[model samples]
Target chain A: MSWLIDPFADFVFMQRALLGCIAISLGATPVGVFLLLRRMSLTGDAMAHAILPGAAVGYLVAGLNLGAMTIGGVVAGLIVAVLTGAVARFTALREDASLAAFYLISLALGVLLVSLKGSNVDLMHVLFGTVLALDDAALTLLCAITTFTLVALAMVFRPLVLECADPRFLASVSRWSGPVHFLFLGLVVLNLVAGFQALGTLMAVGIMILPAAAARFWANSIGGMLAVAATVVAVSSVAGLLASFHAGLPSGPAIILAAGTLYLLSLAFGPSGSLAARYWPRAHLEA
Target chain B: MALRIRDLTLGYDRHPAVHHLDLDLAPGSLTAVVGPNGAGKSTLLKGLTGELAPLEGCIDRGVARLAYLPQLSEVDRSFPIAVGAFVAMGLWHRVGAFGRVGGQDAARVAEALAAVGLTGFDKRPISALSGGQVQRVMFARLLLQDADLILLDEPFTALDIKTAADLLAVVQRWHGQGRTVLAVLHDIEAVRRHFPETLLLAREKVAHGATDTVLTAENLFRARQMSEAFDDTANVCVRPATRGAA
Candidate 1:
């Protein structure tokens, strides 16, 4: 039992890891809600995979400066958005097909760049994540990104959700949905790039989407969903940190697994509207 | 002023759905566009509402402000939005970015809800509402928009008799208040009983004028018969009204 507190107490690194987890979780959850509501979850997945090549390019060009790398990643994300939009407009192909094409190509390009640089280990760290290895710079970047993400969401909460909930109304009134959508995509890209040093490509997106998806099972209002999603994200981040410390596992995967566990729990036993709500109608009566 | 369309042509991606069609909407009147299933009724509404650009010609005295309600079946209802929040969307044009919902906005939302006979359902989740109830919520939203011209596409689809009657009453109320309404409907009797004007469309305008003159057997037969000039995929078929059934 003391061993639990021992890891936390013995090292500043552990404390930083926990903080980093909180930051990434905070930044990504509401973002996930937007992505899910827009039916862009698959697009989010593609963006995550596509960031690998950009990260490699950034690393090669700027030699691990977090800002430069993030810029590179965001540029890649915008390219994905533009390419997907263009393909959908010009061809008979759908958005998903375009995303699949872009991401798969990006994955190949990322591998090739890493091989060219002869930095296989660093490349693995970028892909799989290295949150435990995060220095002071990465920590600062995560904090700043989290702050910016939350503030932007606060500023545009209504229009963003309004656009998703009823685009026809926006169109009738001449509100441009494209810029808002692109801005959202840009923020998601930033969060992905900022979180990569800590959670890696796969885990960062998983953390963003899974907790929000779980939150959907529990709430019927935007505020309620946002609150629930943020809480689930915070709780799962802590659990993942503790589990990773004790069991000698990678922090990112452990955090994702923790979030996945919460999702399953939400799926199974969350109150009235949850999956548990479906099987146990009598259980719902009490809530 | 009357609404006028001058030789308007429209299409999706250069494939013309409405070809050199002209129309005039009399102010303060209710007009129903009755047609076969593919008769370009929706396209006409889209063209009128400025959603689809006219490939040729232009609109004159098109409503300075317009409200459009899409088919109930066309909307995705899974979003977790409240009735009040849904109606509040109409006030987007009035509010500034990042502005809080003030007393006035809230009042407007409440008034819109009351107008639709749903005054107490401000907090009700949209997904929880019945089909007719949902349509009423949309009507409330349109009320909040308060546009001079209202275009509804198949607003009565899947509704019961009472709900449809209640909805038509709401439309009549709008017309009484001097708002112009162009509603796309499939029921011929709903048109005859409720609306004073009608437009019959089949890729092109088959008839446009008084409901009785437009709903004649000759025009009905022409509307049902597919256009021979265009290929099957290129032609827009408006479904013939199942007359007097409603």
Candidate 2:
């Protein structure tokens, strides 16, 4: 208990970091559940990479400014999303192909920009993240983004579900299909950009997708999945932060590893498609 | 007429699936679009529902309210939605995405569910439902839609006869209410039994009139003939470019 309380008590940075990661978990995991259910996990990964070039450009222009990097990441993500949509619609390439192409290009450009201007330490910080040293602006941004995302999700909840459940029916009934789709995509980009500031682009995706995939094993409804995913993410965040502090591990990778652990645990034990059900089929059948 | 399509050329990738078509679906009538596989039956319904855009000409949707139940295969059945919640989606027009589904709305859903023989299935997850149960659920949703024009694509395909009959009763109820129902079906016997009118299409309008007249041996033979011609290499219908821009 002292070990748990002391780290947070001794350091304001730890408190801020916890708040930031928790905020992200609360907002991003729900969005991640929607992505998983929509089969857009790879899209989330694409957007995460797509944010890199923009953040790198921001880092080059403003030198570690939170506002600049966030704006850059968001713009970059939106551009990739739009380009993917256009290419998929107007060309022979499927959406996944177009998205993969754009993400690869975006990632390459991001690495090039970082290598060209920034030092190795700066690159390390950008790639791996510094959750322990999140500034006032970063914490505030994370909280603001969480609030915005949760509110937007609530507003678009019904149409988003309809759009996912039966797109053609939604299209025939109302003209909100395009708006609902683009709005959901916008939420994905915004959440990924918000997450990258604390978790790094690579590890932020881990916090989202792994928790979401794990949650699906336990629940089938959106509300239940969202709750389960948020819980998994919050626990993973705590475990990662503790590991980073106590064992001298890097925070982002540690957090992702924690999430991966939860995913594995879920795959083995969670009710829906768990190993328990697979091996003990008769009990499940009786139930 | 509930829907009027004039010289409509519906297709994908610039190749027409239903070409040079003129159709007027009468108000308050039951019409079946029966065609062999790939005879543009689905394309024609999609055109009416505004899912597919016509490459040439246009469709005048005379009815303001329209409802559609797409093919079962097209719906992501594994989506995390419950029967009651899904059935409530029919009120989207009135509720506008954000509006609450109040007590009256709940009653409507319950009534709709009862009409389609899906009572007490409110909390059941759609994925847990069998194909027949899912079809019943879709029909209940269609009932709740209260649309002036209802389009159903393979509404009874793969459904057991009892389930089909139960769902068909709902369609009949809608037709009895003087609402126009356009259905795409493969069952000629069901069409002749229930649907008073039929449009037999084979890449073109083979016949369109009374069900018995349209489903005649001669008309079906013509439709089959047209479809077989499609198998040959010389399947393209050519014109002298009369409609090109000046």
Which structure among the candidates has the greatest lDDT? 2
| Candidate 1 Cα deviation (angstroms), residue A2 | 4.4
Model 2 chain B worst lDDT window (10 residues)? B237-246
Cα-based lDDT for every prediction: 0.81, 0.86
Where is the poorest 10-residue window by lDDT in model 1 chain B?
Answer: B237-246
Q: Please write out the lDDT profile of model 2 over residues A196-253, one tens digit for every residue.
A: 8888888788877999999888987888888889889989888888888899999889
Query: Which sections of candidate 2 miss by over 4 Å?
Result: A282-287, B228-246
> Model 1, residue A235: displacement in angstroms?
1.7
Clashing pairs in 1: B35-B239, B36-B238, B36-B239, B36-B240, B37-B238, B37-B239, B38-B237, B38-B238, B39-B237, B39-B238
lDDT string, candidate 1, A246-278, tens digits: 888888898889889999988888763786678
Candidate 1 local lDDT, residue A109: 90
Fill in the DockQ of model 2. 0.67
